[model samples]
Target chain A: MEGEIRVGIGTDADLVIARAEGRAMAQRLGFRRPDPTLIATAISELARNLVMHVGHGEIIMRPIVEDRRSGVLVIVRDEGPGIADVGAALRLGHASRGGLGLGLPGARRLMDEFEIDSQPGKGTTVTMRKWRLRDDLERLREKRQQRG
Target chain B: MSVAILRKGEYFIASIQSDLSDTEVLALRDDLIERVGRFRALGIVVDVSALDVIDSFAARALRSIALAAKLRGARTVIVGIQPDVAVAIVQFRLNLDPLRTALDLDEALALLELRPERKPADGR
Candidate 1:
């Protein structure tokens, strides 16, 4: 909980580093197989976005606890030109550049919770969390009840 | 740094061993294109099973590589996308429809081998 991994994203290599760190952190937090992959994929998307748009950024991975739930939190911040229209940016197939245009929206769908803050010419910050412990416990209970 | 491009008869197989950077992806695209031409390969099978995470950049790169291979007279098949990566791809609507897909390398090879157009003019 106290140890947060911070990865700098400048080039494409940094994207891989960020994803590896994210996956490892998720696993350390007791996330299941798919959850760790999801977290890693989400981090990859965010880090790639920073490299493409801002040219440089940072991703922070930390563990979070709320009530009886535990999850991993990812925060990506960049000092690049911010999105002028957040809604349009989130729309599918909306790309100002040449990429697939699914970075932000895709990352949003992968994580349990997602939030973004940006100001034109200022910067952008994206925060996402995936809660696993509670969900896994709930799934186990469902399986046990079905066996009864 | 160099993605292996193995030659299996007239087919080219590229197995991604680790998470790739954007530059590496581009290099792969170029390498595959060059190999398809150099080997006169009829099909390309890209194995992504080892990659736990694929972002939009990599997805786009794969799509472009497939398209480029097609233009070079080679079919492309992406094999072994994990269930989680598949879910994220569909949820984000990353349009990789142009590239053919298979469950694994075996299926991909079988699909390529079975295609009538892929057979030699002598019917081998």
Candidate 2:
């Protein structure tokens, strides 16, 4: 329950490593078939955010327990110029910086718990905890489909 | 890159592979839409176990397929939800739950009275 993997890379947002990390980390937690799908999604979003928004950032993953269950805590931090619009960034269907608009908000939704902080000229930090099964997230995901 | 359909009595069961990227899904979308109209299967189950990841494009694509099937008078259900994939839906907060999901291929087929579809019956 105590393993930390740190990645410091220049951000070109290559997806292979992020995807592999997602698979390995999820498997270690005994996460089943489709859960890897979720983790891979979050991993890709965070890694892409690091590479794209932060330009150069780091990804640190650790294990944590939420609601009396095991889950992973993924912390993505970038020392780039930071975000000018934190509120706007989290809004659905809003991506202007080469992302699918799902990088931050998407990662937030995929995990069991989501939190983020950023400054316009400083940096950004995202923390996400994902479980083997989370209800709130699933509900939210389904809601949007209905709206659209 | 794969297709498996199970037939039980009258219902046709089909499960798609997860390796399908956005481009691949686009093609499948068209094929399935056509099949839905042609076959008149009572239901559909798409297996997403192979896809190690999901994004907005993928999420939207799934919805499109479901909509397409519904238009063809078929009720579509998605199957093979890996835990991580579920997490991605939650974390990325994508709009996928409306489509449908199952834990495995067998459960997926069982739910809709379907069997894995492999090929056309002797070219009919």
CA lDDT of each candidate?
Answer: 0.85, 0.69
Best by lDDT: 1
RMSD values for the candidates in order, in angstroms, are 6.0, 12.6
At residue A8, candidate 2 shows an lDDT of 73
Quote the RMSD, in angstroms, for model 1: 6.0
Interface root-mean-square deviation, each candidate = 1.5, 4.0
In candidate 2, which residue ranges exceed 4 Å CA deviation? Answer: A1-17, A25-39, A46-84, A93-102, A109-148, B2-14, B38-42, B52-56, B103-124
As a whole number from 0 to 100, the lDDT of residue A130 in candidate 1 is 93
Task: Write one digit per residue (lDDT tens) for candidate 1, span B65-91.
Answer: 888888899999999998988876776
Candidate 1 segments whose C-alpha is farther than 4 A from its true place: A135-148, B116-124
Worst 10 residues of 2 chain B by lDDT: B14-23
CA displacement after TM-score superposition, residue A125 of candidate 1 (Å) = 1.0
Task: Name the top DockQ candidate.
Answer: 1
